[model samples]
Target: MSKGVITVTDAEFETEVLTTDLPVLVYFWASWCGPCRLMSPLINLAATKYSDRLKVVKMEIDPNPLTVKQYQVEGVPALRLIKDNALLASSEGVIGKDKLLSFLDEHLNSN
Candidate 1:
């Protein structure tokens, strides 16, 4: 866990994410993925920028197979916006900073 971002595991997923009061941005990534590494800073920036309104978390796919399977994550660097235990939006791959922020704003603004 770093600043606004919390690293979650299979055991903690339900309690930390599904049960949270705010909308959660679940960042699904793998250590070996280049894009995952490249998107790290952007993810951190999002966590800090949206700290007041969003709960950001990172889950490594290799160590958290149960959650990965549950989320149906087919690739590293995947993002899932969840609120009230429901999936609101999903994006895979490196979508850059502008797109990432807009993605959040688009869905979050409505709710």
Candidate 2:
């Protein structure tokens, strides 16, 4: 497991993300989604690449419908950056690792 990445469940979302002191990048996914599988490694890389500044976690939407609906996650492979209990950024679909890192860098750098 990456130092900054963890597999979070609905039960842990509140404490692991919304209440945490560090900025969080949440990967919203589902087992049956193809793109979710494709994006997993990149998410892990982001976890490592930005380990110092960010806490990255993957939340499976299927088993965690409450989180899914609360976040209004209509699709898989969705990434949301939250801090101070507010959403700071988000992206959808499977993007290249570079682009994904750029997205996170922009927000992480600015914050």
Candidate 3:
């Protein structure tokens, strides 16, 4: 419902994330993952800062096994950057806001 950080479901992954006109940040996280919790706020900040250029979506890996399998996610707190229905890059572990922004910036400008 929020313009910034969106909560995505497996049913909506194809239409909402892969087919989106804007670049998408798909954060794969679990409620029990400590690093995922830590990175959430920074992700929210990014969602707010890059609202126009990006869409940040969070998927709970525990509940979304199909997406986890589709993305080949080996661990929690992973992020997949998708644009134009293709995966550009993925990040594992918790990264700072600057690093996250820099990563997004690199990919967003690649096209």
Candidate 4:
């Protein structure tokens, strides 16, 4: 697990993400996915940057089938912004640092 990110499983998803007071950025990924590997550092940076306002978690899709299916995550390197137990936004593929931060800010700033 990264310094600022928490690794979550299907069993812990509800408690770790949905019930938390702050917004959560769920990073859905797979070990074998090349792009997922590329996004790891960016996710970690986002976690540190938004430490006060958001909770960042990583979920490995293979083992976390329940959450992956529930979230309708069709691919690896997926991101879901969850706040107040609801899905605020979702993105898939490898996104750059600036775009990732902007994506988070867009939703986080409004609420």
lDDT of 3 by residue, 1-111 (tens): 346688888998998898878888999999999999899998899888888788999999988899999999998799999988889999999898889889988998886
The lDDT per prediction is: 0.93, 0.89, 0.89, 0.93
Error of 4 at 72 (Å): 0.4
Q: Write the per-residue lDDT of candidate 2 for residues 23-110, one digit (tens) a residue.
A: 9999999889998889998988888888888899989888888988888887889998999999998888899978998998899889
Model 4's alpha-carbon lDDT is: 0.93
lDDT of 1 by residue, 43-74 (tens): 99999988888999999999899999988999
Give candidate 1 regions above 4 Å deviation: 1-3
* Alpha carbon lDDT at 11, candidate 2: 96
Clash pairs detected, candidate 1 = none
Q: Could you estimate the TM-score for every candidate? A: 0.96, 0.94, 0.94, 0.96
| Regions of candidate 4 where Cα sits further than 4 Å from its true position | 1-3
The window of 10 residues in a row where model 2 has the poorest summed lDDT is 1-10
TM-score of 2: 0.94
Model 4: lDDT of residue 107: 93
Clashing pairs in 3: none
lDDT for model 1, on a 0 to 1 scale? 0.93
